[model samples]
Target chain A: MIQIENLQKEFTIHHLNKTLHAVRDISFTVEKGSFLGIVGKSGSGKSTILKSIYGTYIPKSGAIYYDSETLGKINLVTASPREILHLRKYEIGYVSQFLSVMPRTTALELVEQALLETGVSYEKAHEEAIDTLKHFDLDESLWNNYPNYFSGGEKLRLNIARAVVKKPRLLLLDEPTASLDNASKLKVRESIEKLKHQGTTLIGIFHDLEFMDGLCDEVFTMRKAVVNAYEA
Target chain B: MHVEQPILQIKNLSKQYGAGCSNCLQPNARLEKNFCPVCKTVFACKDVSIDLYRGEILGIVGESGSGKSTLMKSLYFDEEVTSGEGYLEDFHNGSLNIFTQSGQQKRYIRNALLGMVYQNPMLGLKMSFSSISNIAEKQIAAGSRHVGNMVNRSNELLNQVNIPLKRSKEPPKNFSGGMQQRVQIAKALSSNPPILLLDEVTTGLDLSVQASVLDLIKTIQRELQISMIVVSHDLAVIRMLADRTIVMLNGQIIEQGLTDQILEDPQHAYTQQLVYSLL
Candidate 1:
């Protein structure tokens, strides 16, 4: 479970001499294992809200409390970098619009490495990585290849694979299904549904309303840099 | 509907260790892998074959000593292959066998058309050199001499990996595990090769850092549409990034299929065990 209270995230454009209010006193609560989808027009702070939750940008005021099972309730807004890294590692996972990978490493190694760092044994990591990559429809032949050559949909699958390989308690997805074909989207939906069924809380920004409606238990429509929650 | 041609084709590729003795060569002789029970030999890879299309991500999943790494090493010319043929469609109408090329020709093909990323960063990066220099090194080797062009390209690649311009001057030794990996990625992309080969890239980073690096790879692939061959023991990584997957056991491809089909309806007992363990 997560509780966001009066979250205010402002960005100062030093050259422009202007302060942009990306998130304005937004408050929301996502229940355990619930799916919360945020949608709105462009630049509506939909992604900003997710970044705030994921700890990319610190908020000016308000507290983001994560009711963690391993570590008791910790305020994300004020958590130390190491604590945040730990949470990002073991508890929270994020899938953003971009895919960035090491130059020389293969997709399988990338995800396997993620599982290994989480303390999964070498053998288990490989097994789980293979299964996870298959779930997203990534071919076995490409697992050993570098990511520089994958298509748009293939890369998205890889990103999702890396995020959910360990099955974190909280998963934050920012437009994960963007640029995917219908078949690819269906594959991604199946995996997300599986995660939901397994009681993992999901928070996502979905430009596709239909996809959002299908997956989210609750929806937040962001407008004018604020979030308004509504039953889906 | 447009049918796609295979960008790279691997046919009946076999890599054997030690000399094949007369007993081992006998049609009825039963040999223990590369080593004949009657003689001494080792088979790293046996009659392996696959095809890679343009803009496709192919995955190879296997256990340790399954010859998965051997197959990759053979493809990249890191290891000597005993037999079989490999061809790139773009080169000489797919008539040239990559394996038979001379050392100079192989080096040119590797630098100009193929990209290989190893499991360890030490193999891919110069830890003591600045990040920009590391990327520049590859370009320089590829015959680019203009510093201005190289700097711009390096900066663009670094920016894509979320490395700031200010940090470009710093050596990868000073960077975090994830950052160093990103530097390696930028260096790999510096050449802009048609096909990229990666081996066990993210095995050491934390989950969060791994996600960032994976995300970076995703962005590059989507934006550039380069073909890739990824090797890892982990199925989860294969699931996310591969379009087609091959299962390898004991130097042979046991099962090959679409990633979803392999996961949801595994036919082979080994694949079933691999899938079942994930749950």
Candidate 2:
């Protein structure tokens, strides 16, 4: 459901005001139900690609097509902000790399917020949020509790619930397994497998080679700013 | 012969906190001396004795709140130990009692002699600072007089962890979790300190990144010959890295020995259970 053609993004450092070429002409395509893992060391442009796909960072040169819809293609890139702006949160659900959940929000509320943002009705969002939380082993009572009080594993589970509650076709996940423990890690792996089984296309960045090897069907390796072709 | 200098010696370390107020190493045991006049809670650390030698990684294997962090925090002077003293050389003096050192003195030694990396990398760095500047702050905070070369050193170390120079100027908050962790490791090693304490440093990284970072830490330790204390519940990581293993349970050390002794030939019942469960 996703296709990228020679994407490049350059970031200018604020302190030095120097342009650092973070990503240099990287491109790949993911079928409707494929699992893609982008592997790279720090600052290897793994997160930038996901952000670009999610519309957080507007790449300087590149065209992204999701199921025939242009995400970052010049047509939409130059399209008035109003045209592409509404498609982001609705079309692409992103699980941020760091602390995805806010301190004040409950697990249920976070999931509900995601669904509502995508135009789900209030009553429908609430019902879907309950199902999402229950599937992840988050109890109703604890769902009402703020995420700050939840354990690291609980927070990660909530983040996954919030991102996947919408059941978007394209999911951009940024290190979804970082905070989980051994047992919870197993649970998360199973959950991702289920999501893949349901035909939700995924593009995730993970450092855990073992976990990534098991979860990702295709691995994208980037070294020194340039990306090699996707490998299975 | 692996001759080791006794870097830190823990003698009868015990700490009590919260409700229950008893030194109950045995789950059902009831003791009177364990009670405290404060919050009237049971002690968390119980008569813990261990010796950390230089140039070796001491892996503490335990569940959460198992007194591993407690011992580390007290040894690093981040927390106060209720009883027992940790003896260590003062670099110049014959030896210094860790507890006897003043707060400022302990802070100085803590900053210079020890480096701590927490599980969450976000908390470790200033969110606003770039990867280079985050690492630079560690050496600067350690009271190092060399300021001009800090950036250069930062670049080199960040490069060491595979963080590119291009992202060196970008705020670490913008980096991925695995990338942020690499930056944290780079910062921890900036000073090239002697003893390092890592509490779940690889918790937030992907498995592949975890292996790479673990290898990086081992390489750095071998190059610098620094004593390391790695505390984590992941036995696979500890088994792959540590020279010695300490099995902790409910605020007590159930077993302490070489990795082979703990993993292959366990002596304690608790250690046996832990090793067996891992299989």
Candidate 3:
């Protein structure tokens, strides 16, 4: 479960001598095992809010209270770098819009890395990564190949598989299906639905309203740095 | 929350190439690109600090003159640090500063606890020495006296790096650029060091070769669980190998965080430029 109160985040462009308020006084709470979808246009601060909760961008003024399974309740905004790292290792899983693939790393190895970092044994990580990739519908032949040469949709599937392989308590997806085909999108949706059924908290940014309508428990429409939430 | 201690900890590590004047020695001295305009002092590495956790690759990315290589050299004891404290978990229970150790102690540490792979094969490997001898040389330095054991270990290391056993008897000068670099890596791993310092390891290789070398580094880290400090001007290489990345500018760390964070949402202007350029 996560509670974000008065989450205000701003970016200062030093060279331009201007400050951009990405998110201004947003508040929301996601209950345990619930899926929250954020729908917004470009620069609506949807990704910024996710980044704040993910501890990538430090909010100017806010508190993101996370009920960490290991460290108990802690404000992500004020958590030390060490605690944030620990949370990232064992609790949070983030799938950004674009897959940041390491060159020469096979798809299987890339997914396995997530589990390996969390202290999973090599054999177990490898096996789980394979299973996750299979569940995501990635072809077996492509598992040993580098993702650099893969199509955009394949890369996105690989990214999702890597993040969800370890079954993190909190999973943040930033436009994960933005470039996928309808069939690929369906595969992603099924995988996400499976994760949610397993009690994983989900907060995602989606442009496809129909895809989100079927999955999200509530949809929060973000416009011009403001959010309005309603049940789906 | 419980925190894991860094396997290698560096504090205020500074390596100066010239003597400093009073003006340049000030804590707040504004240097012209890591150089003192008034004192003519080249501060190759200025008050650099780093913490390398076990089983992680820490990347140092900077331009050619950003002192990343100097930091690696200092850590490997190839270059003397002007001032700093370096503690290794395997060395005296991390209580002693390695920078202040005696020459013999430093040699012992370098031979047993640390391994270095230089960008230039000529610098890291002997042209006349056979590949097996080059690797065996490191094991021998680490106090392995049995020739039979050294040969077996050297052969195993060469195999790990993908060098053919038949070619292991050939000198490095007879090998290709990529092959020579693989030999250097094999030599570095001969002692089974807990920490590996790689200075521009894949800088000059072909793109395909670079990928293979990077892949080898990743696999080695996973299998050996060695903490590594990988220095390069190439952000792509850093992205591929580093778990955490430190962006250095003018001998100072401008930004550092998880490699994914740095790639996706770089905060500093210099880092933004670097990431955008990669795009």
Candidate 4:
């Protein structure tokens, strides 16, 4: 339900007086309900492509065509800021590699905020957030604890749980399991697999080939800002 | 998706502290840190526009002298706009520009449709007035005449913000910093305004007290569904509370987006530094 065509992005470093090409040229499409995994080294533009689709980065020249369930078919690159914001709220969900924990916010509150911001009732959001955290194997005792004090794996799990709790139509994960132990990784995988089974489109960047092998329908390898996709 | 009009819309709002000269009158006048170097005009807020949706908390974040507080003050009518338009869905069906309203009309709107909690408790609450009287003062200004009804409502509001009944009769001057802020919140909510403007409500409180006040604000938002505009220099408070965030620099909005997006991947260089500094 998403199409990327000739996506090119660059960063102009003013002090250095040079433009760094983050994504030189990349194009791919992900069908509805299918999982796409992007594998690449540092600065290979894997995250850049994801950020473009999420409307965080404006491509130098390209179109990110997304078939939003709410806003019809729209090019994310050209969509109005309000429309992009609306889509981000209701249709697209992104889980970044690092958890940007808000100080004074509890783990449960962080997850519930995802639902709360989208107009979900407080009681229901609270219940669903707790259930999602439990599904991600975060201990019950940590529910009220601040995520800033949590272990890396716990924080990652909490981050994933917060994003997936709302069940957006499109879910973008950036190194979701990077800090997790094997058991925690399995739990996160199971939760993601469940989301995919429920028809949420998944696009994830993973360093673990084995973890991605069992999940993604196709793998796109990026090298030096170029992408090559093949069936898993 | 069906489009929803913003509960409050501000367009091209500008507030300046001095008379403009030829050098600063130009549309593209370059200012030295939000002040005109030649004319000595301080542009506290320049061409600021904002949209606050129903039941959402919109955050304005910037460092001191960035004019975030000025923007909040202008919206709450504590400061007059130099030029701009403000529309509230509850005011004249969103057809009237509130900035141009008559003094009486402006007072009516402020009393009925808007609530503001200042950063300093002294600015928002009377020092010698009992907490309940402070809240009742707002309800009375909003046209509540029955003393008994006003008292009950004030008690309920005080309790809602976690003020104990025993302390309700005490003046806010006797309260702790956090408690004074809570009382200020109760006073602001007394009018049952559709929109609430809060300026650094938890800025000076202890860490533990800050958390509780923040928690109280979140709970109040969920329960009351009041659209709020929160102004603070603290990005952490904005991240915890704001649904959408606007980043201000030198009296102008440099960047704005979903709070998650702003914190995750800020686009502007200034915003990048602000977000990175948080790490």
Task: Evaluate model 1: give its TM-score.
Answer: 0.55
Q: After superposition, how far is residue A184 of candidate 1 from its true place, in Å?
A: 23
DockQ of candidate 4 is 0.33
Model 4, span A1-232: residue lDDT tens:
9999999998765445568898977888999999999998988999989888887777889888999887889999888667877887798999987888656788999899889878888899989998898898899999999888889889888888888898989999988888889999899888788988999999999999899877999898898888855555
Model 1: how far is B1 from its true place, Å? Answer: 2.6
* Each prediction's whole-model lDDT (CA): 0.83, 0.74, 0.89, 0.88
iRMS per model, in Å, is 23.1, 27.8, 2.6, 3.3
With candidate 4 superimposed using the best TM-score fit, by how many Å does residue A188's alpha carbon deviate from the native? 2.4
Best by lDDT: 3
| DockQ preference between candidates 1 and 4, better one | 4
What is the CAPRI rating of model 3's predicted complex? acceptable
Among the numbered candidates, top TM-score falls to 3
In candidate 1 the C-alpha lDDT for residue A170 amounts to 96
lDDT of 3 at B175: 93
lDDT of 1 at A156: 91
lDDT of 4 at B23: 88
Clashes by residue pair, model 4: none
Residue-pair clashes, model 3: 0
Residue runs of model 3 more than 4 Å from their true location after superposition: A80-82, A229-232
Residue B2 error for model 3, in Å? Answer: 2.4
For candidate 4, the share of real interface contacts preserved is 0.17
lDDT of 3: 0.89
Q: What is the lDDT of residue A187 in candidate 2?
A: 72
True contacts kept of each: 0.00, 0.00, 0.25, 0.17
lDDT of 4 by residue, B182-217 (tens): 998999999999999999999989999998998888
Name the candidate, 1 or 4, with the larger lDDT value: 4
